[model samples]
Target: MVDELQDSVPLLVFLGVLSASYVDHVALRRHRRQILHLQVLEYYTRPGDLILFNGRAKVSALQRSLTRAEWDHVAIVVPSRDGGHLQLLEVTGDGVTLSPLTSRLLAYSTFHVRYFALRKLRTPLLSRAVVNDLLERFTAEVEGLSYGLSLRRLLHARQTEPALSRDSTFFCSELVAHAYKALGLISSSSEANDFWPGSFSPGDFVDAELGRHGASLSPEIIIDCKLLEVATATKRSPST
Candidate 1:
């Protein structure tokens, strides 16, 4: 049975790639009208915002298939503290790192970005300074840890009760979830490893088959994940 399942793995992955391609097509078509220029996005976006990436690569397709969601990766916006430049705090293969937002978007021509804003939330409890301090401390603590992609741990996630990750390693969504939890935006009981890239998505997009434990945000904080196409060539106009 193990041999048979092993032999079928390739076929399953191939089918996943095909399915993800179709979904990408439909999603891009539906949100084509809502695309925004990269510069315009950078100017308006601030810290504590979330960014989702949808890539056309086979690995990305497999991720989409595994999670049964549109987003394959997630990142949090962070203050650059360098003349007000925009940067993203993300967990890549190189581990937890900061990268210029515009350059990262420009790196992948086939990948499109979706923005999630929290600026609309007006609550006295939502302190930007506190969140920023937490972000700084969190990033400083886990800056160069290895990206966690252990198949064993992933399989363990299938169990009735998924294990909480308190290790140094972090995948993209796990890192974001941890940050959210540290900022008091999510419940302390929320397991970072239980969150996939799709878990942070707006509305009912979370996949039940993945065994994700659904870490919801605080009721006071509203996430505006409007699918805006980030244009590579488009520049911000002179006037606001």
Candidate 2:
């Protein structure tokens, strides 16, 4: 059975891609609730939260299909350093950027914006000093880092739960994994974390399997996955 399933992986991936490609054609078909549900979410979420995104773009839809995951993108919530509001740190095609979460909602018209998981730690994996250290390191060195361009590496990876890598270059999941390893959130050896990047995709973080009682990672790391909207389906925009 295992062998048969392995052989079917390719067929499954193809079906996923084929299914996701139609998103753009029926983008307007999505039904949205009339009342905007923003104030509560904004008031509830604070800095250091993680957001798993189901982008409204054809590329995002394609990835969602490919990974068979509800979310295709992940970003870290960052409090504005200069004050006033919150922002997100993520590597899009434009590379790692700091932007307001509120602006993100306003920028898009698609209903996909409503589909995001506002994840946070049940208990902080690291101290404030450690968290600051990691943030500082990324800030100092994240410049010129580019979004990883290939899904092939993730697809062809060894059948390991937490895939590993050692490259300085960045992909969205790799970047988040790096943070997980650095803050001692993952149980593998620090050495192992270095090579653990490409093995796991974003879905692995939120997968049902990983939340088993004795699983290495914590379940509370994911706080809430609310599907709210910046705008209703009446307007369609796009994702990464």
Candidate 3:
């Protein structure tokens, strides 16, 4: 059964993030709500329709809302970061079911933008064959260490060395290409020199299309991954 199911059409899952540093916690929460609402209104309706969320709490709420609206397939997007050992959870009208985590780990691991891109690119290779190949190659590349150890070492090296980082980015892009290829989607990892043109600064504002799968899929949405941090200090009265 598992082998037969593995031959099905590949699911293309793209993960991206809006940085918490660029948007405050309050604003980020609100933005998430608005985005989910828009998605529900735009694409999901009736039973068996899927609405995916990275967070479990959000998934629960979505499940209730969708059930109230008569939707069935309330799929939650839980990227398994801890290798392939841990099972991912999926909730629906029939209650929660456990499945092998296939999505990229970045979905829940961190709020970093680059991690999001890398993870998204890695999702299409979740099949047993591709995953086994990736595991073997990754192991071969970083011999002697446990899988977790090797992954940590790779991540650290990518962070500490500029050349390694660049190579890692290229590797991530290649993975994304492979994912798209598996799913039969056209993909281009074009680099942008400047997110905004002219004298525009950080908060100036602009809209960019991140990527798109096809005519049937909704356009990939990209918004500024910025967050603002504020600090306040209390004043002390002068001594008499």
Candidate 4:
């Protein structure tokens, strides 16, 4: 019996070590996946790319409820010259403006943003120079434009109808549509209000919404960034 017990001791220790090794391997792989997912935005974004948001604010909730869409906001990516960071062209309540990607991400905790790339064929439509020129001209022309927000407009959007005419003010999705139009990606006859935030999302629903305006803007999503909490934790981590 003593000899049998001594033989079992080595087997038990080996089994325990083997189980621990497997657990550690699994944890390391999980950690790697989290890091890769977080770095996706840096790896995949390009000029004219898009970032769509599912927001948690009351206004955002209202927009999503009315549109029956998951995303309630969108921004166009503008790559920096130094290739060190990215900027976003968007229309806020403050009107048309440029904001840093990191700052925007840090500011909005209750939003999940996804990266979308323009179709390869459509990417050739606007050169970098043209994109810059159009943004500059558009920004200057609509410097102090108000964000299109009112009960009337909200009701109109619920109907999914385009505004009768383009106005001096612009809304979030409207601004993106205008940019697409100027880039020759969408029809010239299309008005800005023809687009709502949901129009950019991928689905038969978005296809029908944009089709109603006689234009199309489809971008493929590269990353959903659902691991936003992982990013937040990294931010909270002490610097090395």
C-alpha lDDT score of every prediction, in listed order: 0.56, 0.48, 0.26, 0.55
Residue lDDT tens for model 4, 26-128: 2133321111132335433455556666665687778789878767787776655454577777888787777776566545543433232222112444555
lDDT of 1 by residue, 77-195 (tens): 77765536777889888888888876665554334443322211111465657656777777676667678777665444542323434456788987887777666666666567778
Residues 1-240, model 3: lDDT tens digits: 644332222311111122223222432443321111121121122111123332335543353353242121212222233443333333222223334432222233234122111011223324544544443343233222111113333222433322222123322222222223333333333221111111011122111121343212221122221211111235679999
Each prediction's TM-score versus the true structure = 0.65, 0.56, 0.22, 0.61
By summed lDDT, the worst window of 10 consecutive residues in model 3 runs over 193-202
Ten contiguous residues with the weakest lDDT in model 1: 218-227
Q: Model 2 over residues 90-203: C-alpha lDDT tens digits?
A: 777887677777667445324555354455433233454455566555544554566664666445453223443333456676566555554445444333322222123334
Which parts of model 1 are misplaced by more than 4 Å? 1-27, 30-33, 81-83, 110-124, 153-167, 204-240
State the TM-score for model 1: 0.65
Candidate 2 vs candidate 4: the TM-score winner is 4
lDDT ranking from best candidate downward: 1, 4, 2, 3
User: Which candidate number has the best lDDT?
Assistant: 1
RMSD of each: 14.7, 13.7, 18.1, 14.9
Give the TM-score comparing model 2 with the true structure, all chains together: 0.56
